[model samples]
Target: MTPADCPEKPVVDLRSDTLTRPSAGMRKAMAGAEVGDDVYGEDPTVKRLETVAAEMLGKPCALFLPTGTMANLVAFLAQTRPGDSIILSESAHPIHYENANLSMVAGLLPCVIHDALGKFTADQVEQRIVREDDPHLSWTTLVSVENTTNRGGGACWELHEMESIAALCRRHGMRLHCDGARIFNACAVTNIEARYYAKCCDTLCFCLSKGLGAPAGSLLAGDPETMHKALRFRKMLGGGMRQSGILAAAGLYALEHHLGDLAEDHRRARRFRQALEAEGFEFCLPSPTNILYIRVENSLRAVKTLKRRGVLTLAHGQDQIRAVFHRDIDDKAMEDAIECFKQALALPR
Candidate 1:
């Protein structure tokens, strides 16, 4: 499905990894899945996916949600009571991308901190906390951190930094939540264990559909009590599925085969950036993960030009364009994208 504001035949669609269709392998796995009623909590294959994902992330429990948006929303609601506020970077997905689901469903206010580069510290979190004694201030009860933060140029946070901020949250009696949508990209880029990062937060959600190439699904991991509450929230959000093992099977396959391939995505992103740089295109910086942001002299014209050439991507603003590499996009697609970009830039004034 198309995931961007623009569209084309997609000779090389780099709009977002979410646009990837289920691979042949994923389709095979889905067709053979063992199914049962999941809302009743009896779908064995779905349960297995949750159990295995929880074990991989070192969390006691996991719940499979249809979308990462739902996973994030459920975590927010489960962790904070109504009128409580959740802290996150200004560029965080929940703040800018999730259509205010956190506020609508969770009744939680967002305390946005400006950190466009994805660099924030324990002190930053501490400083953002509001006092309950102030009637004008909302009670800040949760801190949300994003791994390989999307608008942060796909920069990964150091593990120690995550730990320090998480510890500060614990000390301040605030829960820590991680919107780890592309966290495997963080792990692949930093060579860190996913469990290590998982240990640093009280709850976290990761996508199976992005770098992993699963057709759909995200796992929300946390302690059992919190996860039980997440499950209830899932049902309330109409996210509880029946016989969802059919979809969970794809997530299981991705977990087994796709995790190791994320390094390749990062490599392709770097290669793409290098090619663009060679063609005199400007980029914000080197993307350490699968996503890259290109600074164009005229973003709308560039996007229109690329679309006409059968390539697809999104403009970040009037001067920036964003693209992502995934399993489906290979060396050839990158070559085509670079060529299209070169042609677009080389157009006569």
Candidate 2:
């Protein structure tokens, strides 16, 4: 159903940060954005956004794509050959959430490392590395990591750990890629700069639609040569766009205005976590950013009960519910959400 068809504005929408609609200021920017064909590299606004994104990530170049999944696919396609293998945390978005694009589209094999917190040490990477002498194994070519890991309750990878992993990849002649969909959230909470995290990877991409509140788009950044190669894969994957500056303008506005406000979302999420904890709710991990996963007796029933109370959340698993805070949810909405949870807990199974 269309947004206007809803009975009323939701008291709180913890389903995902992607639910955020463009703000008036962002809409104004989109309306005034200049137009050009991006496939031809002539879109002035898109170029500006790419440049800003690259500088922010301390990369030599950046390419804007329609989605974070596409950005990741192109990075893999550019970095690995068809028979090569890549290593990733088993809980990564590509493994569970991206429809197996790494295997289906990129034709790459995956070496999964199971980790509850969505992070694995350099030692784990070494264990997963295939021996080159064993011709039976697919050559491990790339290592990918996610920041503010989605399924891991928005856990951020420590910089030292990332540095160790990057060093290992370099030593093994492998490329490092970062699925930095929530890199800004990590930066906001840890007081680390985006560049430091970007520097730990051979290529990295961050979403404009998630915490940034843009209508659509993600930017992949890396060295110029690799990005040039990725550009072709982007088009091969049908990601080429014409006059995408309208969307890029929203990304630009988000970068300029919405970035500083991410801490507020984190604060709200923490407050929500505290309230749930007080109600005897259990979480898989600490809420470091805007995402939290609460353990419930029956996730589906809890979600239904919360919805009946004008609150919205997602059933993450049979017994887990995921809540994500964003620009759209305010302090009042958060309190209402907490109260709704309390009420849901009081209901009979």
Best by TM-score: 2
Q: After superposition, how far is residue 35 of candidate 1 from its true place, in Å?
A: 0.3
TM-score, one value per model = 0.95, 0.97
* lDDT measured at residue 245 in model 2 versus the true structure, 0 to 100: 99
State the lDDT of candidate 2 residue by residue for 1-349, as single tens digits: 2566333867788899999999999999999999899999999999999999999999999999999999999999999999899999999999998999999989999999998889899999999897486878899999999998998889998899899999999999999999999999999988989999999999999999998999899999999889999999999999999999999999999999999989999999999888778767788887699989888889888887887778888888799888999999999999888888887776343
- Cα misplacement distance, residue 245 of candidate 2 (Å): 0.5
Predicted candidate 1 versus true structure: per-residue lDDT over 1-349, tens digit per residue = 2446445356898989887778888899999999999999999999999999899899999999999999999999898989888888988988888898888878988888887676688898888797557878788899999998998888898999999998898788899998899989999988888899999999989999888998889999999999989999999999999989999999999989788888888888888888877767778855789888888877877787888787888888889988899988988998888888888667343
Q: Write down the lDDT of every candidate, Cα atoms only.
A: 0.87, 0.91
Clashes of each: 0, 0
Displacement of residue 41 (Cα, Å) in model 2 is: 1.2
Error of 2 at 226 (Å): 0.8
